[model samples]
Target: MATTGGARPYRPTLRAMSVVTFNVSGVEPVQGTFDDLGTPLHEVTFVVFDLETTGGSAREHAITEIGAVKVRGGERLGELATLVDPGTPIPPFITVLTGITDAMVTAAPKIASVLPTFLEFIRGAVLVAHNAPFDVGFLKAACAELGYPPPANPVVDTADLARRMLTRDETPDCKLATLARVFRTPNQPCHRALADARATVDVLHALLERAGAFGVHTLEELTAFARAPSPQQQRKRHLAEAVPRAPGVYVFEDARGEPLYVGKSANLRNRVRSYFTAAETRPRIREMIGIAERVRPIVCATALEAEVRELRLIAAAKPRYNRRSRFPERVVWLKLTDEPFPRLAIVREVKDDGCAYLGPFGGTRAADDARTAIHEAVPLRRCSERIGVRTRRPACALAGLGRCGAPCEGRETPEAYARHVTAARRAMTEDAGIVYAAVKARMDRLAAEQRYEEAAVDRDRLAVFVRVAARMQRLAALTRIPQLVAAAPGADGGWDVHVIRHGRLAAAGVMPRGAHPVPYVEALVATAETVVPGPGPTPAASAEETECILRWLETPGVRLAQVDGSWSLPVNGAGRLLARIELAYQGRDERPAREGRPLR
Candidate 1:
């Protein structure tokens, strides 16, 4: 090897060293395909385990020892054991049972350094412990803090196996000691994990033989039978029984009565009960049970109408316990200024003005999104400045950028920019159909000029318009509102007119009983009969008729349509006038009306 200035070049050595991860168990096969003692016992592919703990209860104790034996097809292959010095005072009761004093394990390695080796040894084996969950739960809790996924392998609880095999009369309470005594298995110092594990293994051998005779052979069957009645299930059953069955929304409360969960059903009782008995579990439901102290139900109308009422209540209450619904209310409006050069601004909140307002969007975000969109579509000067941009000697930054069209600098004519702004506003607020057509026209021109890249951009913009149009079409499919025309009752006095809109029965309306029971769809259809559709609403309808139609459409169930599609009206003087102008519309574009405020 070449040497540097004063340092010798490093030489690497080629040496292979085999390192075994860990010994699985102390039992070793000394006979033909089996351990010298156990039987035609095929090596039981299991993680035979024991845990030395500071106390008896798994909940409040820490493990102080661990040991295991790995067996495959009834043949013991390896052994591993460790005395963990649990960093806690070992109780006198535990000390007497296991004979493992705190002093004995003081020199042993800490759990942090030993667990990795232990896990490696048991990697492919089904964990087997006497009363497995107690040990397993403690081990898993330890494992969790280390970011380990809890063992996915089945855990075979030997305690359960012993009880199933032993005669009830001979041994009713199958304690490890009792079973050890009955089976003649030697009792090593009980709490010493390794010695106890050895005793458990002996008991396991006998139980396997007993279980095999009764045809309980597979690992799956063994584990399933073991995990039947955990304390968690009993708790869930108690909760389910407490919820009342009724027509209402059930609120699951934590100890504080702060709603942790809210759910509604036709049969409150049945729905609440379903959570307890169901085999398939929802993690959230399990979480609720962990903290829940009480269940409360608030009665409501029919189940069919629960969703609507639920939304109203949730919106009003803004409950911390209830998760917010994904679909939120949006409210928006189009603002038309009273200035000489009128500017339209899409706003989340509408201002009182002589000009029109379009909507209260279903949600604040939706309305804000709409505002951003309209602003981008129409880059008109919506600033507080009263003077025309072109009239100024020094143009603002907007004019400096091409966005202003240099009208402020007088490079572009005021009339031309105004025309463009008008077109842009129309495309944004009233309807996007105009914007789509304009973009389509520009795209055609670009393609004709062989500007493919520019044409592609236009194509993308057109796609956006198509998407918006499709969404609008879908919205229209779900909602149908016709112009409302006031009507008289039929001869029989039973209401017969078709209601095109949902009308509230105000005290001023007919039916002195003050009942606004049924909404009048006929009113909406009759109102649509007044507007003649072409470029816009007709001059005749624009006078007083337009106001009537707009007012009626502004009602809850009625929405204003830019174009009147179709309608049916009675043949009265007002109806006759409406029929005549049903298709007539003013060529001028009307600004969208301003609703009260954005739907927050």
Candidate 2:
């Protein structure tokens, strides 16, 4: 069915999987339907390692020894143990503790040379360490000094895992020595690198065995479990039990029945479950979960529907936890005032009063910058006061400066001023080549005079003008089409069809596998909402909604079934102008005194 502004569409709310089951162990049984939970632990390769350094601080010390054991599926693939030359004398106390004298590592290779070999040994594996901060920090510091990018591998700290899983009955402390004794592995730690690393691997297996009872089998679960989630999160894990494992928007409503937050995901169950797990690291979400009393899932047939619905829901509800897409009114527009001596004006609202508009700019600053660029290009008056055709007033200093034609004092006739208004209107909508040329030439003039900073400001303003003009014109083209029928390839050998009228989503549905799309398209178009054209580019829909439709149309596999109008931009339009302006911006920062300016 069709939905207008703030209206609900008729779609399936997945309720078939809402039946709850009891688990004696008090753990929510892990479901296979949650596909976004990352790689399984057994399928992941792990490099369990330990490092011995000269000091605790990575910034102030050097690594003395490195030891690693690479394992997958309880089988050891390889081992790396190497001594590194500290490049300084070993302290007497350290030599006595680890039983390594200064002469012991004299023949060893330097850290810079050995780092590459160690990195290759642990390539494409999860790094496990006793206290990861001490080991990983030193490796990162060394990589920075040598001008190599830091390793992009996932890390698991056995110390933090042990703290979250075991109690005083299991072990009094989370230290490697205590865990090694509790697990009673073959290897014992005696201040040696390889032995301690081997002991850590044994403790890691023991912790995993304990975690299995709590449904922590995946790597994503393992990392989140290490964060020691709050008690409230555990108690509220049942809220996600009724959520369908489908693409949709989920609202977290407080006890007062008001939405606390709104979010959308391809897999609703998996994403909502993550909020109660340690995987959700946002503090605001954590707070929202505490106040939320129920999970309301609105399942959709496709992710695009979920996205559009989420935007509208957030805008209507103004949920406290959601910071974006809530206040469309805050966006300002730059419209040419509909007057005898028309000028560019920043307006909070768009009206169908036969005026040209350039925006729905993000803020006043952007609209103001676009206004300045238009004035620079078109020689429009800058005063805020209104001027009449018959009334005579004193001209401002701008007339003497030759920036204005002195229309206020009748020095410039109404017919003459109308020409500038026409140019300004053209710059805002149909074509932007004139504005681009004028701004670029002025920027070039500034750069030639060694005024590089001032020229850069002009470059930024021109960029703003180009981007907004292109966006508004593109939206204008879309909104002018009375009705558009399009289809995007669905994931399951089907077609996701949409009916858009005046750039607003009128109706949407998905055709099943091997089903004919012609009937589906015909039925949707017949049942689609009727949208009357409003003034300006975005009529029935917000500028954001029209842009969303434009993006969906541009996606790779979309096919246009029908369009009411030409539904195309001018051959020479803002798109081409934006490209040339971007090139000038690229060279805007360079030295102006060197030679040729970038505007040409």
- In terms of lDDT, the best-performing candidate is 2
lDDT (10s digit) by residue, model 1, range 355-404: 54433344444434444444445556645556464365555677656555
* Clashing pairs for predicted structure model 2, backbone only: none
After superposition of all CA atoms, the RMSD between model 1 and the true structure is: 23.7
Q: Model 2, stretches more than 4 Å misplaced?
A: 1-146, 149-226, 584-600
TM-scores for all candidates: the values are 0.38, 0.65
Q: For residues 258-356, could you state the per-residue lDDT of candidate 2 as single tens digits?
A: 999999999999999999887774556866887899999999877777888888899899999998899987889998998878888899888979898
Model 1: residues >4 Å from true position, as ranges? Answer: 1-247, 277-282, 326-347, 350-403, 406-425, 428-430, 438-600
**Model 1: how far residue 13 lies from native, Å:** 44
Model 1 residue 236 CA deviation in Å: 4.3
